[model samples]
Target chain A: MPNFFDLNVHAYPETDVPVEDMYRIAKRYGYTGIAITNHDDTEKGKEILPPSISTFVFRGVEIRTKSVSELKRKIKLHYGEVPLLAVHGGSEVINEAALKDSRVDILAHPCGEKGEGELSHVLVRYAAKNGVAIDFNLNAIIHSRRSDRARILWKMRENLKLVRKYKAPAIISSNARFIYDLRAPREMIALASLFGMKKDEAIHALSAIPEGVLEHKWKKKTEVEII
Target chain B: MKNAKCKVQKSKYQFVFYILHFALLLPPSLRERKRYLVFEVISEREIDKRELLEEIRDSIYSLYGDVGASESRIWLIDYDKKKDVGILRCAHNKVEEVRAALACIHSVNEARIGMRVIKIAGTIKGATRLIEKSV
Candidate 1:
């Protein structure tokens, strides 16, 4: 089995559940590792990694901001501080800004948590060039029903098309706040299928792409050193 | 003559029993192929079997609609409330579709829950064995 990683999970200060609880459950669910990417606004000061579980629980930040300039500053602030830098994407402007910057890692929920954002081919091409992986948060699909779920699936389908055309890296994350929100990797692949993602593509998104993102495989050497 | 009559009567009864068996149970070739999925659930509190089954059905209906739900042919074969694990059966070709529906269910009767399929098998016996090994 390939090593599966969930790069956008929230825990501790973001919610009531602690990192240890999330790590234990994620390990039980068969994940190779999980990144605790609490929202920057909610996080209190610098997060100290619990030494015991540090190997499997990666510390990351999900920058949630409105203005483009502030987003840029935050990216500059957190770039090399953490192993993963996820931008909470929504709105046309934020999507474009995040994708354009090569420093940004994964763009979590490009369509917004509620399926409110949009991405065009140009933005996707930028993501391709910048090596910013577009995240498809399956929680949106799992939580919504009826028309809301339909809309999210439709938006994801459109985004998937763009990602495919540009050959941009894509990742599927639970984006789970609580332990109950997590799903097994196979279930994630099945959920991805709901939005037109093929089996192989979903597997790659859940495993290979996230691993590459962790290793900064697509990042330029100079960009890495400058941080 | 008596032995021959007894043997003939026994043969006739055997033939009738075979016909009845075929009539009551579909022949293997004609039977619909099914897969058994052994799954585990983690929830806020104990969930009743009926409630969980209802939620599963509702999820399938809402996600796939009537026609698609019918094609899946979902059925709950066994559930151990204490263990929070169960065996569900569905059409062989519809496993993935059913899996998606199962994943869509985030709650049951207001109790938040998460579910995952542990293993899938072609027979209930195989699924049960998997459940044993996993537990």
Candidate 2:
């Protein structure tokens, strides 16, 4: 019942809260593990993580495309494997290109002119082929002003359909900026289901998908298993 | 919330909404449907987007019966150093024919061709009126 996963979390100079507090609050939500994913800055990720606490702390980054070459170069340059490396916002151009290479693990919040992180049937099919995980972002769901809810829901509903179609590679996250926003897996799953996600599908996203990505990033295929 | 979707009452409500939309449509034989408008301009500079959209919407309604906006899917595309508007389903017969029947034929030298289509929803008059005079 406590099974949970969070793919998008950050630590920056803008926020004064300490990193240990983030982990402590996640523990309150009963998270089995929490992946510390932030935007483009890897050193920041290296900075905040204190001695590994109770819940799993994953190191990752949300790579914003400086340019195509920069994207390829960064992927090749960062030898250290990150548990989650998401491309921020929803754009098909970035996802399609990033997913082609195994170096990229997650396509975080892909949005088109239509809005939302949506991959076409072609993309859904290709992501499965390349093993790039699709993100179902919860930050916008929880934080957006009510006026934008319908559009966000519309975009999320379309994405959920794709997640259902491509089950193995789906990932879900709070995309949290601050410690207070950290949500338990159940809470995230509940919101997901509210926006047309099936119950089992939401659960699978928080548990298996994030865990699987971590394993792949670590290249530790044989490590502990989840039922 | 997982079981919420499965509730019988929710499905019944969903069924009713679908039925209502279907009833509103005119069906193939009796329906006026819409015409697709493609405008080619002769402007050299990129026209202001809002200005261009307003011109296109007004043109469609002027020619095609109060053709407000049926369903507009506008894409501001730049190609061949030329910008064009493609209005898929406009109301009037005036904005008729395919390939080359564009009205308000302005300067061909610097203007880019544009087009817009209207897809009527609910009440055609009230629904299609998203097209404003200025843009």
Candidate 3:
């Protein structure tokens, strides 16, 4: 089995559920590791990290902002502080801004949590160049029904097309606030299939891509090599 | 006359039993291929078997619609309420489809729940063995 990682989970102090509880459940679900990316607005100045769990639970922040400048500042503030830096993406400007920046790791739910936002091919190409992974939040599909779910699936299909064309890295995350929202990797692949993602592609999104994102494997090298 | 009447009734009953048995049996090659999924549920509160079954059926119907549901041939083999584990049978090829449907069932009677398939086996005995091993 490949080393599977879920890079977009939300735990305390963002929600009532504790980080340990989330870790235990995720471990049982066959995940190698999970990142607790609580929104920066909620976790401000509060140390949510528990010393007991280190390697299993990676500390991360999801920057949720409305303005491009503020988003930039927040990314600068949290860039080196955390192992993973995700941007809560919605609206055209935020998605474009997040994808354009190489420091930003994953763009969580670019189409908004409710499928209201959109992404273009140009933005996706930027993501590929910047090494930003476009996140497909499966929780939206889990929670919505009928028309709402249909719209989310359609938007995801569109995003998948763009990601494919641009060859941008893609990651699938539960975005789980509760333990119940977490799904096994196999089930995640099945849900992703609804949006026309192939089994191998979904597996890569769930495992290899998230791992690579965590290690900054795709980030472009800026410094010149000393010969 | 009573003895003759009894004999005739006995022969008629035997004929009906044979026909029923034959109707129930299918050639191995013609039998519908099935897979048994052993799953466990974690819920906010205890869920009744009937309620869980209803929720599963509803999820499948909603996700795949009537035609897909019929083609899936889903059946609940057994459920242990205390353990929160159960065995479900579905068409062999439709395991992934049914798995997606199971994942879609978020709640039953407003009691939030999460389900995961532990293992899949080709026969009920194999599924039961998996449950035993897990427990």
Candidate number of the best lDDT: 1
Question: Per-residue lDDT of B46-107 in model 2, one digit per residue for the tens?
Answer: 66656665654443333223423333322223222333332334444422221111222222
**lDDT against the true structure, each candidate:** 0.93, 0.57, 0.92
Model 3 chain B is weakest, by summed lDDT over 10 consecutive residues, at B103-112
> What is the TM-score of candidate 2?
0.56
**Each model's Cα RMSD:** 3.5, 19.9, 3.7
Comparing 2 with 3 on lDDT, the higher-scoring candidate is 3
Contacts from the true interface found in each model, as a fraction, amount to 0.88, 0.00, 0.53
Name the lDDT value of residue B95 in candidate 3.
96
Report the lDDT tens digits of candidate 3 across residue range B13-124.
9999999998899968899999999999989999999999999999888888999999999999999999999999999999999999999888899888999998999999
**Each model: TM-score of chain B?**
0.85, 0.42, 0.83
Write down the worst ten-residue block by lDDT for model 1 chain A. A218-227
For residue A122, model 3's alpha carbon misses the true position, in angstroms, by 0.3
Position A31, candidate 1: lDDT: 94
lDDT of residue A213 for candidate 2 = 81
Tell me how far candidate 3 lies from the true structure as C-alpha RMSD in angstroms. 3.7
Per-residue lDDT over A105-175 for candidate 2, one digit per residue giving the tens place of the 0 to 100 score: 78787653235455677777766766778787766655443446557778878767876676538777877
